[model samples]
Target: MILISLIFMNVFAITVSLLIIVADKVMSNYGSCKIIINDDKEFEVNGGTSLLRVLFERKYFIPSACGGKGTCGYCKLKVTDGGGPALPTEKLILSPREMSSGMRMACQLKVKNDLKIEIPSEYLEIQEYIGEISVSESVTSDINRIRIRLTDPKTIKYKPGQYVQIKVVTDEGTDFRAYSMASNPNRTDEIELNVKRIPDGIGSTYIHSLKVGDPIEFSGPYGDFYLQKTHRKIVCVAGGVGLAPLKSIVQYWKDNERHRRIELYYGARTIKDLYDHEFFEELARENENFLYIPGLSDPDEKWTGETGFIHQILERKMTEGENSEAYLCGPPIMIDAVMGVLDKGSISDDRIWFDKF
Candidate 1:
């Protein structure tokens, strides 16, 4: 009698577990979903999943530097119809234009119903890569210059001046942070990123603590802030860690035999803050069309070379009608000031692009 009771109880438990699993799969599958994107392209996708993941699988990628965790706010799409309400996770980031235009957070919205959405055309080229750490070198004081090798989905084919999102975890929770690609597209297997230590920021804190062998997951090849196809001279200005994408662009131009005159302006608080200067100086020598300029904002007593702020040096040198494409990345204050000076030099607003961090 005791043996029979134990046997019956075990069977019941197994049956319950199977039933629960079946129910979960059924609830998660919402059937085939029809996506009408930009009201022009239609996609039929398996349903009951977040729009972010679905779009990527279907080849109409919307940029989400955070890999659909609902943190970075880069993966936004217009949900004209069939979007069922909104999720709490997305409320903090949606702007007024986004909230009113039938737009919804792609990561938050599941394919419960037939949907119509819109995304920028440039984002169509971005591809997610599952990359393994190839190298993690201490390039500067408290800064780690990492190289990742692409494995599954094995290549990040992107234009110069684009960025990828690296995943980060901390004692508190999981989140994602954006970092620009510092390596060129020519070097397909390995991707390079520059991570600076942030005092209390979650993502940087976690990355700073990581060692050489640690594996980190990331996605991208995102952003429209790339070099325009033009014969005009190029001026790239960067401060602190903003040099990542700009460096990629520079390397690309040099590798492709681009003969257009290019000037790079890098700013540092002191000599100690400047990184990889000798390498860039060598690049400048190899490519006669390129010039490297390093400026110090507030140098120590031992400092020399170009003093004062970066923008001041830039303003003193720039002449009108240079017919230049200006790319600036730095703190907000520096970006705004550069914009003002560029405007004064008669440079078109379209010619000026900046990355503010």
Candidate 2:
């Protein structure tokens, strides 16, 4: 009697396990879904995948600095129909006006059925490029200045201060990382990037390990952080690797002979952290309208230049009002501090363009 009872319980458990496996196979299938983009282009994709993933897989490159994590708020799109309502995670990033206008984070929106999405026409022009590493040199202890020459296209046209996305494949999966172009815009055949090593950062690690002649895949020419056409005096602030885009802008100005009065305040923790100082100093010597100021927050006794936080020094030096436009790129805390300084000087939000990393 005991043996028969044990046998019955074992059979029942086996039956329950089998049922669960069958149920998963049936429920996990979400068939094909249609994605209508910009009302003209259409794609058939498998359902139950994030909209960002689908677009990326299809090579419709979107600017996602955080790679679909929804933190950067860079991958917003307008969904006219069939996208359902916004998720809770999206609410944290989207403004009320944006939400009312059908804006949604593509990373958080799942493709459940046929959907219509509106993306910017400029994004439609973005293309993937194949490039080979031409040079990889260390600018600082942790920062590497990498230059890549386009192989397939042989050329790329992008405005100064714009950035590109580097795709790195690892054992875990593929990841995309964005880096500003440090090379001059006039150089169409090659582009340069300033990569700073982060603690256990997958993208930086991969980039640092790259050797000359290594093949690289990337999509580019994104971001509105480029230098605007303004006669206003320019005040540029950069910290650490944030100087990448600023370098491009300054280089462009040098090449074009733009004589607009410009003042650059670059900050680093110590003298050792500073890179490309000599280049800017030479520019200042050559161009009467350009001024380069390098500040060290924690300088040693050998340091003689400006000391302390950069924002404080900028506030002391900058002339307030609508006559000047400010461009800032740095960590969030530094950006906030600089913004406060700019606000106190009566620089309106519109004239203050910043990229917070």
Candidate 3:
């Protein structure tokens, strides 16, 4: 009887211990908090969560291309008060200029007490979308220009030239990558995305392997690189797989019959990488306001198109201070070169928007 009592007591103790551990997390309350933004707006929120998650719940969107994984430093908020310490993960992403300005990665800074953080007013305009993969189709050479039909409670409202983060599930776990929405705005039921097969990119590998019926997870309508509401002339530049967002921008123009005189310079190493040219040319023929210039940087003998570096042609075509907005999407190197050329030509920084892959 004494042995039986001892066993019961031990079992009871273990169960209590487990319960306490679980309760500490689920019922762990951090009490009240304050988030002061730009020293103007003060939001009282529950503390003890990362600033990223809290701000999102509060409807203040911070751009995080990596989905709060601390990998992409897009979600930097100025934490002027009550954020604990500068975490090692945050240290990895911060630049000297960002650190000096008290900017910290929102995913890294936990709200130990009250906190003050700075964010762009534009962030307030961003929204979180729980999107499903309605269709994932390959358009060209292992590259997929997938059309993700938004399911669930359905309906997604977004501007052309914006992007979303797809949660890629792998054997290890899940990771995130940003892709531009290539769908036209006329249809809100489904949006489109173009994905390049990165050699070992966790997301792209999984994407390449996914079929039509697989349920996928995604979020956002992020980035500031959209067409400005203006009558100014435009230049759209893109590289290999960077045509995704620019395609969205053009789709918007076509739907609205936007009459801004536009020139698109799409560059690829060869004809194989170039995509959707026929469709774009169709638009050019229909709308005299638009023109298409597809260039093959390193052309084969059989290639019978514009065969020169794209920037050189751009230098000759675009007028300086023409009140033109230039949208670029491509690799970092291409973007920097174009930025330099645009700067030399007196294009204001405000007139430029891009998503560098």
- Model 1 ranges with Cα > 4 A deviation: 1-61, 65-73, 83-101, 107-114, 120-125, 169-174
Assess every candidate by TM-score: 0.77, 0.94, 0.79
Clashing pairs in 1: none
List the global CA lDDT of all models: 0.80, 0.90, 0.79
| lDDT of model 1, residue 66 | 59
User: Which candidate would rank higher by lDDT, 1 or 2?
Assistant: 2
lDDT of 1 by residue, 1-357 (tens): 999999999999999999999999989888888999777889788888888878766766676665577776777788888886667777788877778777788888888879978777777655656767778778778678888888877776777888876767766665657888889878878888898888897777776776766777776777878887898888888888888888988888887737788888888888888888988989888887887888898888887667777788788776443688899887888888878877877778989877777
Q: Residue 350 error for model 1, in Å?
A: 0.7
**Candidate 3 per-residue lDDT over residues 12-99, each given as its tens digit:** 9999999999998776577788888888888887767888888777867677787677887888877777665678887888887878
The TM-score measured for candidate 1 stands at 0.77
lDDT (Cα, tens digit) per residue for candidate 2, span 1-357: 999999999999999999999997777667899999988999899888899999988988889988788899999999999977789999999999999999999989988889999999899888899999999999999999999999978999998889999998799889988999999999999999999999899899999999999999999989999888878888899988999999998898787737678889999999989999999989899888898889999999999999888998788777655698888999999999999999998889999888888
Best lDDT goes to which candidate? 2
Candidate 1, residue 27: how far the Cα is off, in Å: 15
Whole-model lDDT for model 3 versus the true structure? Answer: 0.79
Worst lDDT run of 10 residues, candidate 1, spans 59-68
